[model samples]
Target: MTRRIPIIPTAIVLIAAAIMVRLGFWQLDRLAQKQDMLARFTAAEADRTVHPWPRGGIAPLGYTRLQLECRSAGPAQPEAGRSASGQSGWAQVVQCATPEGAKARIVLGWSSQPAPATWQGGAVTGTFVPKGEDVLVYADPPLAGLQPNARPDPRDIPNNHLAYAVQWFLFAAIAVIIYALALRKRLRG
Candidate 1:
């Protein structure tokens, strides 16, 4: 059927289509970044052992790789972030066991979202950062919520941006298509 299309609608649709395409690309970029980051972390941990934080005299200013046993389970707590609103994070922990089965415990900060847990005879290679220096003795507790042991697997985190990007791009495309139809109708009219 012949119908009149308006220029405004046509223009809006085209603009929307362009935006959607841009969003889709953004998601792809995010996915790439995440994969790269995962690869880097994996490489760093491979063939490496987790170590205790250096005691004093200038912290390594970096992380130390250490392998913790699975039996070292600890309750995780939220280590507040600088952001005004942030999730109570997992206060990751490590437990060192003596041959006799006795144990020493330490609360480690979140090592990203747990990835596919690497285990060779119940051990995990993780980077150890020194307990952040606390100027106020009581201001922020250095450690909290310790458990026996655990080896959380690395998760293949979803990149929703890709989906969102797709959505935006789809919207943009639809917008453009609508605009084109509108323009066509208006021209005919």
Candidate 2:
């Protein structure tokens, strides 16, 4: 006697497996895109040459060194920041009036304690970093009492797409194996 595979269940399993595999490939594609973005960031950071801050409307400043002499427009605004050594702490961000009369914010430095007295602003040299809709300067050789926090890395961005892809592929294999085992058991009985 010949045994026939259950058409409905078998079709469902194949469709599910195909979808899982497709999801895995999609994740892999995301991984490649992430890697390319990181590479671009690195390339931008390599050149030490500093450029003047843009006088016109805002621009994309993901990874570039720049020079600016901004005076403190207000007291320091505290925000989260990471140290060069990867320590998490509070960073002082001060509002400043640019030479062209544009309002801008600059991340002064990272510290374990709350921000010190009202920050005394000066001619600052640092890297321009994109933060949400605003761009802030991450001071290099950080201001006198503060530690250096410059050249924020793109590698810091999480790139777990490959691992997620592996998980999807594994899920597809597990589904196939379980279905095969169930089919064999049904055939035996």
Please give the RMSD to the true structure for each candidate, in Å. 12.8, 3.6
Question: What residue runs in model 2 are displaced by over 4 Å at the alpha carbon?
Answer: 1-4, 55-58, 67-75, 80-89, 95-105, 120-124, 131-136, 141-145
Clashing pairs in 2: none
Residue lDDT tens for model 1, 74-112: 443334222112333344433444233534334443333
For all candidates, what are the clash counts?
A: 33, 0
| Range of the 10 consecutive residues with the lowest summed lDDT in candidate 2 | 142-151
lDDT of 2: 0.78
For model 2 the local lDDT of residue 10 reads 99
lDDT per residue as tens, model 2, 109-182 = 77776755266777777777667777678877676477654347766778999999999999999999999999
Cα displacement (Å) at residue 118, model 1? 28
